[model samples]
Target: MTRKLNLLLATGLTSLMLLSPAFAENMLRVSYPEDPKSADAQMTTDFYTLPLNIFDRLVESETTGPGQSALVPGLAERWDVSDDGLTYTFHLRKDVKFHNGAVLTADDVVYTFDRMLNPATKALNTDILTFIAGAEERLDGKADSVSGLKALDDQTVQITLTKPYAAFLALLAAPGASIYNRAFTEAAGDQFGLTPETTNGTGPFILRDYTLNDSEMLEANDDYWRGRPKLDRLLIRVVSDPDTLRMLFESDEIDVFDMDFAPTQTPYFYGADQWKDHIVSGPRVGIYYYNINQLKKPFDDPRVRKAFQMSIDRQTILDKNFYGKGKLEDGVMPRGLRCYAPAEPIAYDPVKAKELLTEAGYPDGVEINLQQVSSWSSRWSDMNQIIQAQVAEAGFKAKIITTDEAAYLAARKAGDSDAYTQVWSADFNDPDNFFYTFFSETGSKTRGYNNNDPEVFAAIEKARGMTDPAERCKLYQDLTARIVDTDAAWVPLFSLDHSFVVQPRVKHFIVPWNGWSDMSYYNVEVE
Candidate 1:
């Protein structure tokens, strides 16, 4: 019982209740802090673990080793690219069938893209598919269907791009590109993905039951294109409280638990001798940083932004808040991705930060509204407080504002926050996923951060079309240096490690470097 009460923290307590007393031996039990808003991939930005298992994409990221993955075929058995790199022809597998017994064909492929791009669908993350040649026309109600998408035959689909995008395939491999059965989706109409019956896809599992904010039960699909999942069923329970989640794991009610929900106790659970072999940890391919709204007054000045960046001790935040669970990173692009180059570390010097602030016309001091959300991570409350005191030494007063997830996201998109906490995990293993998606003027508009530098925008736009890998990476490196080092667009912090604690009954499991997409639930074998 030494590990029991010692785990409880006073503030930031989550609410999780596990009602199931026991599970079958052939079942895999897991817990999520928040219930998935919907089973539809494109409709909501809910965690992909549920939808990825229920749906298949044109391609997928296959984990080859620890913290490494390569793009492999999923629904498409084979594909060929034109010499110009703008056209892709995918040959679908004839054996694939949806949960409702509809055959997967070229029509389904075309319908999938058409529905997502349709102005009425109002898909949440269609930005990933923006490069498709006629996506704009379809999304704007100018065209009935995407001109780029064409069904050559029952089993053949061809897609053209407006420009040559080197990361196009990787983009298809993302969760948002998941293929849906046109028949099932159309029949359900507005109710698609909201209930179990409408959440049909061709993935390895089929949803049997889903109780809102309680639990979801999925059964192995024998008709799955890939072999049936080894486990008979997947029981995903929503446990909101850290203490209750820990008690459930200790009582063997859950097979796997993510330490992120209870960050303060991560070191204790990780160091517990009894749970040593059950722990799995890897460097996440992402960055956790404080984005400063450049359009905001004081932050608009480069000197002021640089001073804010130099004010806080990032290492201290990593050490105290995370208990040394993450690695300090300087640039926007995280480690474990292609074109990763470790830059010189930004040293912590409060005196120099104060000097920069004085030069920027704030001789006495300045106050900044630091916004965060407790729902995301319990440690953000502690992390923000530490940052508040650290920056105070450099003549910056921090006003901590905590809000719910919905309000925080709305505020961030509207550029309502002066400075806010944000994290970006890679959807695909490409620098374009990081730089172009966040820094470009067009892309930044939706994600907040009103950086409209034409030079950065032009450089990113040029790099997207470069066929040469070396040249593209060099350009990305230059852009990263300018945004992060010179202009201090964001106070880049560290990337946390994806840490999960597993039970002995589970035989094998692995998450990609990014930690969320393509969990490979089909490969999970329970004893």
Candidate 2:
């Protein structure tokens, strides 16, 4: 039978399982607090891929470290880099085809890169591809084509770069680089992500059905480039409320739970003998913090920024809000990475904060508006409120504003907000990946705070140019201390620890450094 027909049968079986509890046991029911804004393969964040199994990338990393080893062979069977480190040649695997039964070709790879580099597409991750020769020119509409990309043959692809980027291979492993069937995407039109049952990619699974506010269903692609997935069906349920998710997991209605409950409440659940076997904890890949618009008044001065940072009690907030479930961050880089520098965390001193505010020309008090998303994890909201109260005591009146998720993200992206809460996850297991995106001048200065300082920009360029890992590490270490100690672009908060629970019967399940697990290898069997 064709893969399409098999997917239909699996959908039918899943619907039946929803009515009967027996077959439901075979389905891997997972729940997340926030749903993907889009699943059009090319237009969504990485969170969308957690449920939809219809996409794969060039290579994958081992959980060991920044080093990457090959996993499921997608379009490329094997690849080699030129000795000068300017060219990469990939040998396409034979007999691989898209879900629509179209044979894979180098033309598709070229087309994919072209679409991604096009400014009209407005892909969020265009920066990752900027290293390609002429990519920046193409993106700026100055070049007719990307000079670095070429199709040597129907089964061969070649890419040329202006300089060597050590993390280039890892960048290809991201979802932004996932290959798509051009014809399928074009035919689906604007309703592609909104459509439920769509087949367009060459991954291990196909999207069988999807509901915006309800659930998404996937079935193993028997004709997958590597091989069929072990699981027959996958169900991703969207539950926005954390309390409801907790109840669902406690009742065994869902096999996977993404966020851990508040630490103060953990004892009530796991303390019970019945729940002891269901708990698991792991390190989170993101840092939770607040960003002050460095371009705006009051915060524009480094002394004001340092004063603000000293006013908040990070440890107290972590203790009360997170129940000491996370670590206080003195530097921007998370402690797990080698480039992290151990600096003394600014102590809470209301007097020192008042004196700095006075020096910044705010003698009486400075009033600031703080905005946050209401639907974010409860710990975040609580932490914001704590800071608001604490900062007021230090001669700054902070007013808290909360909005729905959609409005919050829209305002943040538009760079119209004064102060807001945000998180940064490592894109490629590099400190540059974290700091460059937020602190650097060329990075996303969503708050209109561009680090136009010549010296700082020079340091960033130096770090980017160095290909040696050890030399790069030193450059980043110095850059981190300078940015945190001098510029005060953002106030470091805490490195969160995301916790989850999995069924013991599931196998080959590893939590990636970025908090995403590739579920293609996961299997469920009777113990």
Candidate 3:
């Protein structure tokens, strides 16, 4: 290590120790820009990286194979799907232990899913499990327990889905599908998982301390099912400013950080010769686009919505906000996924936008409010400014409104915004997350502007159940056209390429495309 880095690490950690006395020399320090929305694990919208460390999913993902992730044994030692594809029986691993020293059982897994699917819990991501039979009924209060979810024994669990879904296992890999200790959670009641005290899981790390929005600490689990984690503890410090991330990295205070590069700092990261080996970047299978409220007047007309789409030059916005670091697309799905195919890019024509507005009975053009989450770290606000200017040339009065994340989300959910900037991160890397999440009945209704077209919803559902790769890809391609061209549910924009920094001492740290993983940090060690 450089003499500079050594001295900085020693000094920074010395001060950290004063605050968190449990932090040992083997601890790994890092920074995040947001806080976990809920400790309940069910209600959180923000990905603060605590739940993935605190909870263990049924099937884990290892990035050893193709696509975003390949499923591997996690809490479940082995699992089987029925010949007809409706039933899934999992054999739990014996000797697995939760953080609180209780042995994990099938009942705990059953309890966790029941709690998540219950409408009373109001978990934000329960759509991941709506495929399980009786899920909707359970969520709708028609059933006390998911009829499809039954614990056959202490070490065996069976799940029956309403239909075949190829992505079901992949969905299980997300943190929302985690297995928890039943005894601990039930005793905690509605307060379960709201604090460090009420949470217990079968993960490699145990929650040691959390200071709300400021900082959180996780100590290594000695009895972790896979094995003991390498580091003694891991610290997640919330530093919202991208500039502060670089400052801390330069001072050697934080060993690792990801995707915190600001537009101005893009040069230092891509141009710097000294830190060449320290940087890692990849094209993520994700999409960022505009969510237009079709229920609104101007947007209610498909022509006006199409005009809004063509007015702003996506290429220019990519250049200005992200420095040409992202790939442009006309279709809603991104490029890197196995099933992706390119579509004709929407022409950047202000003249056509004006013509469309006139044809739609708005010769004087239309006025609409655009919404974006207020965050200096977000490029949406920056892009909205350019959009407002570009749309003005097309005879539209674009009023820009900025709000905190919560209010923005409420507006979107209430279908109150004419248009709002939205981003989609591939939870398990598939076109299903693209088409089904935003365009289908479940996905669309959740948004402020929803598409209730029965044909489109049925197509997405059918494609998800198809097993043949060729057939599935064809269905997805057709669905993509329905979304971007026919339905115009979302205005296609650019897919991001992200940058992650790992100091020379950090080992086995791989940044997944979606930016979060269950075992990635568990394997990381400070050399």
Candidate 4:
């Protein structure tokens, strides 16, 4: 029987039977709050939990310490950059092999880049690859392949960019840039990530079995170049209910509980004497905020936007909804980025907010739908409710709309909502990654922001290409001020610290700066 069919047939069995210590001598069980949108690397931002382990990129991120990471060689051993910094030549590691026993080569690297950049593929993150020369042509459907990608030999691949980008290497280290097996991917066709046969790669783990919306069974790749994983099997259960997740962990049914912990219940785990040594926490490299669509009514006016920003009690929300585990900031840039700076403190002035709304021709106030994905995180729903109440006192009626992750993302992309709350984790550590992804002309339009500001966009575009480090940093600081103070583009919230509780038996587990999405379990040991 094929692996897909076997998984389907076994779906009826209880997870306890399959994950028990008696059945699998060495297994690490974990919980995810929701089912990943897609297992395909290029197709998802929500499913990095799977792809981070199931595939290897040209380069990989190493977690040096809390809120810190450095790029290291993955499939590619090393590379050389041209003097002008436009060209990058990467040397392939000869000992690497895909899950299907196919050799990893320069041709595979070329094919991966071509597939991701192709307009026909509808890859969600092609924006990250636009810096490559000829990428615009391919994405515009004017070329069959990326002209800048070349396989010099069986072991070497070269990529040329339109301009010098300091963050180009950091972009390659993103989950979307993971290398794929050309032959296997081509043969799988449209069913690539949906089926077991097509989700193959050259990483530390293999997709042994997957049952949609319930669980994913992964096994260690014995042929892993770095070393065989200490654990034999990794069983990730899809447990959405916070109560159920806590029950599983306390009963020893799950080995690790990280991002799935509810904010309210954190005090329980923190105060417990037994769980003290098992808990790990650190600052994350990301932002949590509300995305305001300028095309929408009421928000189209600058006064309304600024009023909306002033209406919310950000510090109160952090304390009550998030258990005061995060640090509040007024600017969009989070703490871990190099360009981070302290801005003027935000005020929660309902009277000022009412006056601004009155001046904007809405003396009676306005009603807006504030969307949230409750399924993604319960704490978010609680936060949205608090926002709804706070805004009400400022002469605004905010209706809370809830949806699932997949639907929420689709609506956000289509520009279908008045306003919504969301979190954006860094694809890479560069300041350019944050500014360019959320504020640039293309980024703003595609994300349904409908924002138009030539000066801000021009500054962002220039910052990405400057080779001098000090100049680039200064440009970023100016852009941050304009986006936050002048334009009021989005409401800045707190940066929450990432916390995880692991079983005493599980040791050396690394907590990534970006939280669970960037976590890798290859180096973790099970006693």
The model with the greatest TM-score is 1
- TM-score of model 2 relative to the true fold? 0.82
Q: What is the C-alpha lDDT of each candidate?
A: 0.81, 0.69, 0.77, 0.82
> Candidate 1 versus the native: TM-score?
0.89
Residues 1-527, candidate 4, lDDT per residue (tens digit)?
23433464357454556666664457788878777756788998766878888889998878888877888998889999998989999999996889999999899999988998888788987877898999999999999988899999999999999988889988898888989989999898777777567788998988877777788877889899888889777788888887888888898888887743465568888888989779888877888888888988888898888899899999898888667778887886887766677766678899999999999999998988888775675667777888999999889999887777788788767766658777777778788877887789988876767668899889888887777878888888888778877888878888888888889998888778664444678888888
Candidate 3, residue 480: Cα displacement in angstroms equals 1.2
Off by over 4 Å in 3: 1-15, 18-25, 35-40, 64-67, 118-124, 140-143, 194-197, 261-264, 294-307, 336-338, 350-369, 372-379, 392-416, 441-454, 487-489, 515-519
Candidate 4, overall lDDT? 0.82
TM-score (all chains, Cα) for each model? 0.89, 0.82, 0.84, 0.85
Ranking by lDDT: 4, 1, 3, 2
* Prediction-by-prediction clash tally: 6, 0, 2, 0
At residue 109, what lDDT does model 1 achieve? 90
Q: Model 1: runs farther than 4 Å from truth?
A: 1-23, 358-381, 399-416, 443-452, 515-518
What does the lDDT read for residue 387 in candidate 4? 92
Candidate 2 clashing pairs, residues 3+ apart or interchain: none
Candidate 1 per-residue lDDT, tens place, 1-527, comes to: 11221132112121232224333567788877888878888887658877778999999877776567788999999999888989999999987989989899899999999999998999987887888899999999999989999999999999999989999988898888999888888898988888776788999988876778987777789888778889877878888898999898888888887887666568778778978779887778888888888777788888888888898899888888778888998888888776888866777889999999999999998878888886875567777888899999999988998788888888777766558766788878889988877788766655667777889989998988888989998888888888887778867899888788888888777756664633647888888
lDDT (10s digit) by residue, model 2, range 387-487: 88899877888888888878866765665566777667666666767766776665636544555567777777667656677888878877767777888
Ten consecutive residues with minimal summed lDDT in candidate 2? 518-527
Instruction: Give per-model CA RMSD.
Output: 6.7, 4.3, 5.0, 4.3
Worst 10 residues of 3 by lDDT: 1-10
